[model samples]
Target: EHIKNYSKHIDEFRSQANSQGIWLFISTLGCWSVNIPLIQVIAAILLFCIFIFNSKQDMTEKRAFHKIEEDIAKDIDSNLIGDSRKARLYDLGLVEKYRKAIKPVLKTSPIFIVCYIFYSISFLVFFSNLFPRMKLIFNF
Candidate 1:
């Protein structure tokens, strides 16, 4: 019964974590598109909203994971070596789930890095063109 409950809790936490990661990945990309003149204020606002929601989500998942750990610890305190082993296995499963949860973030990390570099270069180009003095410092 405890193991089944543990599995359910972990599954829920995993799903939420992965969903949050997806939102983070989206926001990272959407950052480059933010501009008042470009009429993407709505996207900016939505991204911020998602960020806030994800923050709450992160908290919830953390609490759930912590609760599971505490429950397992209590089981171990009862001197049940079998349950202790099961708890350790469950912990390993959670670690695996976490790795899967971050897949979207890992997959998009390189893309985000590239986009950030390009965005920075483009912004510098625009800035140097608009303010000729800045170009002297950049040595461009």
Candidate 2:
């Protein structure tokens, strides 16, 4: 039961990370299309910061979930070895169910990384054009 709940929580974080990635891509394109260099620079920086934050959170949650699953498996193994009744309670079917619930969380798609790289390149191009204007405006 607790494992299922934790799985749901992790799933939510994954979903949110994907949603934030999409939003970041859209905002980055919008930033690129806008004529105002200052706004583009500011929005690009902010969106990049958001992307970094979301990525960190997603990684942290996944690591934590993995740790929890490992600990649970260890505990189950120890208990099964120590007691016959507990071993029966922690049967293969129950373990399989837990494994099935967590299987999706373990699988990751690389599309997010591809999208991130694409946006990062776009931002670099956007900034490359804006830097000279910034230099001219600031007399740098």
Candidate 3:
């Protein structure tokens, strides 16, 4: 049951992250189209900061979940006795299997940030060329 709940939470986080990414892309595009270098730079920096904050938050939650799982496993190992211990060991094995299955989902990828950086650079180049007045801003 705990594993199920954790899985559900992970799914929710994934959905929220996807939604935020979509909104970030949309807002970035909107700012770019406005052709104001200052606004675009500000929006990009703000959005990147938000992304970093969310990733850190997600990582903290993941650590908390793992701590809970470890505590449960420890309790099963040290607290039970005899027949109940045997039964709980079976359950522990199942828990281990579930943990292995979800391990990949819990990892935070760096590729997303790399892509964001690439996109930002490409736009900076494009903007500098398109708006000569903004060259000072970009160069700075």
Residues 104-137 of candidate 2 have per-residue lDDT tens digits of 5345424454567778777666655557665432
lDDT by residue (14-96, candidate 3, tens digit) is 55555555655665566567566677777667767876677557543555556766766677678878888777667756655
Poorest lDDT segment (10 consecutive residues) of candidate 3: 105-114
Between candidates 2 and 3, which one is better according to TM-score? 2
Global lDDT scores for all candidate models: 0.56, 0.62, 0.61
Please provide, for model 1 over 1-140, each residue's C-alpha lDDT reduced to its tens digit, 9 standing for 90 to 100. Answer: 56556566555544555555465565646655555523444554465577567656565345545566566657755656676677766674665465456664455354444444554455455456547876833545
Worst 10 residues of 1 by lDDT: 36-45
Which candidate leads in TM-score? 2
Error of 2 at 29 (Å): 1.1
Provide the lowest-lDDT 10-residue window in model 2: 102-111
Better of 1 and 2 by TM-score: 2
What is the lDDT, from 0 to 100, of the residue 103 in candidate 2?
Answer: 51
- The best-first sequence of candidates by lDDT reads 2, 3, 1
